[model samples]
Target: MSTLYVEQPWTSMSLLFRPHYRVEVFDEHDTPLMVVRESSGPGLQRPLRHTGFSGWTSFDLDVVAPHGQPIMHIAKQFGRRPHVRVSTPAGQLIGTIKTHGAWKQSLHDPSGQQLCFFTDIGRIDTGARAKRHGKRVRRDRVQINPQVTEPLRSLATACAVAFDVVRGTGTRHTSSGGVDWPV
Candidate 1:
């Protein structure tokens, strides 16, 4: 079983920039795999349309090779639940990432079958009792289907990273900023 790890470098200075992330992916053995970064230039109009002035601003992310060639493209859709679609440079759909809640997200195939699930490790209960006990925590666990092939597996990994970026699950301040509940 091949496992991938995603980490966002935290620089206190990042707070001054226009919301961008520099994410690094590593293998189980701790070797660097690929680098995923927010597109540095001007934001594209089409993708930005879906991301309103709300706390969540949708944008395009690129999975870059060591030599700086973008290998994959991840774009966030404009709507409730905010589906993030992963594709190749040629625009072929690889898979999509969707969140069920602040702590739970899943990756799906084009047909919408779940291929992987990512859960933020923490006390999901937010009741008075749980809050009084100070049980909040932060970490991530990814569970991927064993039957998925290599390329799709890679895309699923990228989906996990994209999920964190769009949702801002890494920082405590913005953890629940994008949540929208039904009436």
Candidate 2:
């Protein structure tokens, strides 16, 4: 029964600069375990700059060990909702992470059994409300099934962090006071 804590830094005023988002994974005692960093690959700057015009964009990130060895890769699919693929360093598919609705996201094995679930505990607004409130009102909580094994657990953790990144939970700054987004 190992537990992992994932943390993403708060970035203010992200529109001006393309920030390299780094997500840190920690152990139960708060010791650092791994670091996942966003990759600034070619053609990424265009979509980031013209966000409104860009219909869909893909991103690739690297998961690195504490000693700086690359262990896994995360690739996001282009779409309105979050969809990510976890792969080995050699590019073999491990599993997938997908957003089912506003509050629920799931990690599934290649065979399609859900290994973990992520639920957002706050209000989810659409249309004008979402534009006005952004992602500030939501808090994400991840639950991994105890039956999952070691390697899959690690992959699930990485997928959850990647989902957070794609969902803008890490980049959006929450305000002290605001109405929750409409359901």
Candidate 3:
């Protein structure tokens, strides 16, 4: 079976957030065609603190297939819901949006392609707790933005990371290696 390889960039967002992952490239038959590897780095346990709160960094990735196209290209969104479009080297009108929160576009793009993606956490507010017997009261509230980095940049970083992974895995260029995501 033929194989292709992609590189893993040390500074990529996926590496910074996930730091470690298992990648396996499969053939059309769902067989393990080539290049399966795992990685870990120093950023795995690093914590980011802000405004008396601590949260983990994350990166979001989206991959979409254009109408009548065999290959799917990655997409970027501007915000959480009612998403906005971002520019790519190929222009922004691919017209693929995710109905559910979990789905994302994935594609193969050469390096230096300008792209944008979104990232943000939902907000919450808490009031207080009180006791009546002796007149005791406690008041507090905490709102957290779980996102540690910009979504657009994070998505870009994700794309770069995926590209690196695909490149590093070195599973491409082989007739046996293919990209397929079942609908």
The most accurate candidate by TM-score is 2
| lDDT at residue 102 of model 3 (Cα atoms) | 24
Which prediction has the highest lDDT against the true structure?
Answer: 2
User: Over the stretch 71-180, how does candidate 1's per-residue lDDT look in tens digits?
Assistant: 88887643456777888877888877777775566767878787666432111112111111242212133445556674567556665555554453322222344532
Summarize candidate 3's per-residue lDDT along 46-87 as a digit string, tens digits: 233111111122212233222322222333222233222323
Which regions of candidate 2 fall more than 4 Å away from where they truly are?
14-18, 45-56, 111-146, 166-183
Whichever of 2 and 3 has more lDDT, that candidate is: 2
Question: Which residue runs of candidate 1 sit more than 4 Å off their true CA positions?
Answer: 15-18, 40-55, 78-80, 113-147, 150-152, 166-183
CA lDDT, candidate 3, residue 113: 36
On the 0 to 100 scale, the lDDT of residue 114 in model 3 is 31
Give the lowest summed-lDDT range of ten residues in model 3. 49-58
Which scores better on lDDT, 1 or 3?
A: 1
- C-alpha lDDT (0 to 100) for residue 129 of candidate 1: 14
Q: TM-score for model 2?
A: 0.64
Q: What is the TM-score of each candidate against the true structure?
A: 0.62, 0.64, 0.22
Cα lDDT of candidate 2 equals: 0.54
Q: Which 10 consecutive residues of model 1 have the lowest summed lDDT?
A: 123-132
* Backbone clash tally (model 2): 0
